[model samples]
Target chain A: MKHQRWLPWVFLAPTALGMGLFTLIPIVASIVLAFFQWDIITPPKFVGFANFATVATDSTVQVSFLNTIVFVIVAVALQLGISLGLAVLLTEKLPNWLRSFFRSAFFFPLVLSAASVSVFMKYLFNEKFGVVNWLLSLINVPAVPWLTSPAGSAVVIILVYVWQNFGFSFLLFLGGLASIPTETYEAASLDGATGWRKLVQITLPLLSPTTLVASVMAIISALQVFDQPYVLTGGGPGDSTRSAVMVIFETAFQRLEFGQGAALGVILTIIIMLITALQFRLSKRFVFYQ
Target chain B: MTTTLEPRRTASPRTRPAARRRRIDWGMTGRITVLVITAVFVIGPVLWTLSTSLRLPSEAFSLPPSFLPLHPDFTSYAQVFQQLNMALLVLNSALVTGIVALGQMGTAALAGYAFAQLEFKGKKALFSVILATMMVPLQVTIVPVFLLIRGMGLSDTLLALILPALPTAFGTFLMRQYFLGLPPDLAEAAAIDGATPWRTFRSVYAPLAMPGLAIVGILAFNYHWNEFFRPLILTISEQNFTLPLGLVSLQGNMGTGSISVVLAGVILSMIPAFIVFIFGQRTLRTGLTSGLGK
Candidate 1:
């Protein structure tokens, strides 16, 4: 029963070592690397602010930046809207088996890797032989160039991203819906609030905490999207679907430009940090904790 | 959870008026219709993938793409295994995922126990640091992490992929939250019985934390299994590739002509996750809700 002073440290040592080596140190190293040029072979040369200057002027970086912003906005909006709708519907009075089945079915895609989904969707959206175009053609519609055109590929990426991710938000929303006490609904009904009015006045305000969490999660994942776009379009169709992470990957690994890549990473980190901070600050009026 | 709501309806049948009951029926019908449509929309692509994976090569791109293959073939599965060397890639992915899962579970449990039970200097500050790391996206640190791995001569090796991910901030946070919710009297009784801290943790807390452990393990497995970017960056040769990387390579080499084979590879890659999901659906759902809902 003696309190061993070092026992806690012993317990913490492994995680501390692993996290420090992998996450903490690397983070600091990334910030430092943004100022230096290195190709993994030569000694890094210090070039303060030069990499940042390049990122500011780089057209591909600009395109990727714009694409990432647009992708996050559209994807988050669609995902939240659809997932919340599904959650509300699924939580209604239905056969137990049907409810469970629908829940599992909707969540099935979350278990699959984004890479697999991307590949399957790439084939699904194939310009010539894809099932999507085929289905469109069945209705006397002309074949659409899904992955071949810039705007088209962008749309595909957003849709694919939403498909792969909405399940997560759906699950969270279900949890939120379940936690709402039945008395609240009864109270709202007594007050003559039902349907759209009930959802907007009572359910939504009470569910704001869940909404806040889901929105934050959706935004973060959407902004960091790499796998779907990478595997599906390879950042192609003239770099339409290229995300910030994809650009960083190509810049560092393909072009062997570590400094610029590090710079881009820093810029991305700052942008995400700022956005998350702003969300938290702005959420004060909307998020209801009780 | 859904079962709890069922009784509310049964209890209301006698008290509810006829008009209310009829309205409820209409609502049920609308809900079922919407649920069916959403289910189809969500699961349609997966079914399509299954169909394409089984279809014969010639029938894969037939003018009217068959909803179901007329003559199903398992040959593409064979092709993926034989021609693309998927077995090795699967084994590699399994190895990495297994190690990372075990590593994360063990480390997270130990750290979580300490943070939840023991009083240590700088514990609060240290825990906050871990939480902060969760907000720092992996993309932000990829350059340095990549260089660090290369410097350690782990590039192109499974170790490169496994080592960096072993200590997960989210996993530790989850385990800690679970431990915090556990009653403290059990640990206190163990201490009064003259059990050492390690024994108390091993014999008492660890067993009770199985649900938390399972959640962490399933999540870690799913993440490392589906991971694409790290393996793509770390490994250069086909021999070191994981499933995602291998599937990409298969697509590149096979092109559109081998669409069936590629779909087979995709289907094969999805099976393990599907199996895990089928068995662990409850645990996965509980884990997700608990982690985020709190």
Candidate 2:
């Protein structure tokens, strides 16, 4: 009995220890660290509500917070809409061989590293002789600074985020669509519904749960946009393209304000948690699981 | 009323057949339109890059761009090997991803076995803790993890990259779910046969749960192979850089755009993932679809 009792722990000990040290401790410490000021060389000093107050009032924080909102709204909304549309189209009674081919092609980018994608995207949008610009110029629209200007760069970032992530949501929606019984569609067809009318009435209502899950994920990911903007624009043309996480990175690493960065981290965490919980709550009304 | 009467009186047989054919043609056209649009949007940039990589600087910048490379060039691929040591980076990424996959699969399988089968105290609590940890983004702990690795003198070492990732909560969670689907009688039979728990896992449970293990392995492999941030922050020396970091380095080091080199680097970073997708397509697709829990 004694030997048997130790076996589970033996299996679990390493994982538990690592998670405790890396995950649990840091999560707790991140919240606690938000209340203190530390610069690595000096010992941390707790200043109860002072850091949070300062973060609330900081102009940089406000800008990033607003930027994050815009990013999440556009990125998440479009990602869900387009992916769901694609998923429906792909789930049609196509030949299995072609289905597999289309699935692989759609999912190709999902497997690539974000850094690689960012690099490629940068070149794709390059102004002077890049592909997108060249294509635009063919229609007489002239060049648009993709990563150089502020507004144009923001649009580019959103476009990249959508392109990279829609595959994931598309796959999820495909799975969900596949699970829907053929009887529902047959019944709809019998009612003389087809095309956009059927899509709006039948498909949209049935795919709500998948949409919720995909949207929540998209929102969380969009809010935490770091790698794309970081590598593609370096959050550049001045902090114009900087995201909320970019601000956190700069605060912690560049300025060495560890405590302030942790504060931003906590704020972001709270915001994400609240938003995600709200999504679940709201999904109760719209997301029909069955 | 007069127009309706005229049509009813003089309905043309040719017009009726043509109208029916047009209806059929419209559906086909709609499907074709959607497919063409998707193909253009998804495959266009990739094809453009491949062509761009094969062109000279003059050819690359030329107006009314040549769709195909007039004179194909392999210089960029050569440069990646000769100048950037991309082959070494590929080896590094492959080694790290492989080790991480093995460790992750082995650990998740064992841990998942304990969670699923063992009637241990704190089982539910421990599993909950793991689930909750999934919500905590890695961005919060990255600095501390870096500091931890640095303190251990493992920074810039492959160990720095591999060890921290061994206990993947998602993988463990996935395995637990997979194990739950297996028949419990196998474990019970093994126990009745005087097999130790370890023996039971190795012989019965592991084989029964091979599909799940493969799924976990693919996910872990893809993640680590494509992992960028940790390697970037942890490894200071260029020699220790993974493929993604090497690609970033190549991007930063380029002068006058160096389009071909960048494309070559992009292609280099893509090969492992592309190969994984090709070889493990079924497992990867099913695993990701299931793991995402839609």
Candidate 3:
């Protein structure tokens, strides 16, 4: 019995140890380190709330925070909408060939790395020879500055985020769509319900649980946007595209202000936690998990 | 719920014939048109990158540029090797990704097996903690992780990247949920046969959970291989740079107009992940959809 008792602990041992060193420790250290000032090489000193105050008042941080908010709002909204639409269409017993083709085409971007995607987009948006510009020229529209201007850069970044992440939401939506009973649709058809009315009454309400999870996840990922902006714009065109995470990164490594970076990270973390927790709490009202 | 009401409302026999026909036309034409437009907007940039990669240096930047590289050159890929030891970077990526995937899978599988199959004190609490960690944005930990790596003097090595990745809370949760579907008698029978826990895990539970493991591995590989920020801060040397970091450096050298080399780097970097996806697409899709708690 004693030996059997040890088995659970033994089975849990590997993950416990791994999380202790890698997950728990780092999380605790990062939180505590936020209260101190250090340059990694120097001894850290208790600086209390100064780092927090400094980050809060910093103009650059404010811009990044705003950019992050905009990116999250726009990108998540667009991605979720497209994904839900695709999910509904694909799951409606469409021709298998078309379903497969659309599925692969939509999901293709999800596999490609952000770095590569940005690199590819860089050429596509190139002012002189880019295909996008070339295509626009055919329509008699002027070439738009894509990565060079602040607003332009944010637009591209948002587009990329939407493109890459929509697949995940689509998959989840597909799953939710699969679970809906055929009898429900059959009964609705008998009653003469159809189109947007049918969709609003049936699909939207049924997909609530998936929508809640996907929306919360989308928000979290949007706030954590790093690679796309980092590679494409580096928060460039005058700090216009800088996200909160970018500021944290630049503060910590580039400036070597470890404490300040940790402080910014902690603030971002708390806000994220609060937002996500609120999402979880609110989801209870609407989400009907099967 | 809404989908149920759609076909009924539109296809109802009570509706006027002309209006019904118009609605049918709109539904079919409108949705397809929008999908096609979205596809073009979504995939245009990526396709351009592929075409650029195949173009000769002269054709790459020619004004009113070539959509398809007439005389396609694989020279840029060769240049990746000659200039950056691209093969070495690929090797480094594979080694690190492989190790991290395996390490994470092992931890996740064991923990997940326990969570699903074994009962113990604090199990609910511990599993909830694992689930809670999933909500913690990874960005919060990067600074501390970097500091940890630097302190350990592992910053310039692959160890830095591989070590931090092994403890994946999400993977554990995924595995646990998957394993929950298996009958308990399988493990109990294995126990009766006198197999050790590790042996039973390797020979019995693992094979049963292969699909879940594949999903875990594929996601892990895509995540680690595509990762840019960690490698950027951790690795200092050119030789140690993974594919993404190497590409960033490659872009720096070629600058803006050298579409040939830049596109080449992008194309080359995408190959491994694309290949994995092609073979693993079904598994990934099924895994992702089904991977969340049933």
Candidate 4:
């Protein structure tokens, strides 16, 4: 091929320009806006560290951050735990059609819109007219106020988030499980290892790399969760289910506090980056790559 | 699977009948029980939604709710259409997601080709930067993005949702991986024939990369179709709402509306994504798994 000086640049222009205008520029604007006080109609005024200080001391924002953290931990754990369990089960003996059927069944939720899922899930979890309480009554249990109470909404949020998300980690774990050579398992079997012992000594260590990737991806997405709680609870029972993104949305849009919103966004972005960086740092010791 | 079946299959001749009973072993029984229970748990809610939507609005909360709708009703579906601008919502959502998907495919394919097969400086740094943008959650930049959209005179319109989403990091990475996995000899053969770089890509590589383009396109459609946060912030008018945002309002009206009607709206929203799931399941699966490095 004859050397073409600008062909690559031509190819790169659209993505480069679009990302610059949209992603890169907005990020810079968000940082800058964090230092200014402006409603949608007001002239922008420089506020220095005031916006950050106000946002830091804001009780709702603090609770939302704390809620976001608690959310990330529980949702990620349940997501990884359930997905790993299902992935292991799928690897067991089953008809090919049956296996694929189960796989699709688990993965089906991932394809649905989260807002829609939250909508239906809200109905299902309703205290009086919902199926959940109906079933609970059938079992001689009391109706729970799933959406009204703080702890109940927290449980509902985790359940709904995990239900929609575990399939992703399941797919990752499936991929990881597929790559494990059967010979290693056979050698363990020859040494009289069976069931639980083999899973601990062989399957787990061999699957660590995939687990690392799955957990990291799961945790990152879980931290930014919004659709479930925003729709289902509307951050009800006094900011109980409000997520960090919900706060960002509320302050910037509903309340029209753009500067404080931007500050909260910056703080969240920093925390996300720190958490991600910490995971990678810890991966050095725990993640087993083969 | 072979590991599970090996012992049974290799059982000595007289033990074959015993093998048949092996299916009742505690491990096998427990495994099947868990799988069946899980299958029920995972799929049950959606079924309940469908059944509830089909019941009369008055029967939406019938005791011991039936999975089988004895007398299927259409009143709720009628209510949904009457209440919302169903056609406009679909039109708006289609316009946003369709164009966004196509735009992402174009940008991702070209940039992916450049990163995969073309020679350039700062390529490594550029690609890593693009991938790093994935970590910047949409909430973090959305306020400024709304301002940027406003600045462009596209405020309070569907374009606000479509434009900011045109540049995608994951799609680019997927397409790049697709292009890199392509056989090297296509470009080599075109080069040996004295083709220009443009000619090589246009004639040789582009046609073969359709599947890759499709993966990106489908990924975009599935994502933007269900996207909520951006549309929630950017689009304000009722006519500008996507399916998810529109459906959220349906839920918002729960104080006055029947639960069946709300569930009907929810079920209506799931149809497009469900159709995509059926036809593009394998493509979506490959797109998800292939994004992970070896």
Top lDDT hit:
1
Error of 4 at A287 (Å): 1.6
Where does the lowest 10-residue lDDT sum fall in candidate 3 chain A? A1-10
The weakest ten consecutive residues by lDDT in model 2 chain B span: B55-64
Top DockQ prediction, candidate number: 1
Candidate 3 matches the true fold with a TM-score of 0.93
List residue ranges in candidate 4 displaced over 4 A.
B1-24, B183-185, B191-196, B254-256
Candidate 2 per-residue lDDT over residues B1-294, each given as its tens digit: 998778866777778889978886777567657866875787777777778777774465676678898788888777767768887898889889999999889889988888887778889999999988888776777656766777788988988898888888988898899888888888788888998888888998888889899999999988899888778777888888998888877788874367677787787678778888889878877776775645
Error of 3 at A49 (Å): 0.8
What is the alpha-carbon lDDT for the whole of candidate 4? 0.87
Q: Write the per-residue lDDT of candidate 3 for residues B1-294, one digit (tens) a residue.
A: 799899888787666787867877777776677667767766777777778878775677676877777777887766667767788888888898899989888888989988888878999999888777777777778888888888888889999989888977888888897889888787778878887777777788878998888888888888888888888888898889888888877877778746677678778788888898799998877656654534
Local distance difference test values of all predictions, in order: 0.89, 0.81, 0.82, 0.87
Chain B TM-score list for all models = 0.90, 0.88, 0.87, 0.88
> Who is ahead in lDDT, 1 or 3?
1
Please report how far candidate 3 places residue B148 from its true position, in Å.
1.6
Q: What is the TM-score of chain A alone in each candidate?
A: 0.97, 0.95, 0.95, 0.97
lDDT of 3 by residue, A154-247 (tens): 8888888888889888888888887888888889999998756778988888889889878887888888899889888888998999999999
**Which parts of model 1 have CA positions greater than 4 angstroms off?**
B1-19
* Structural similarity to truth (TM-score) of each candidate: 0.95, 0.93, 0.93, 0.95
Q: CA lDDT of B106 in candidate 4? A: 84
* C-alpha RMSD by candidate, in order: 5.0, 3.8, 4.5, 4.0
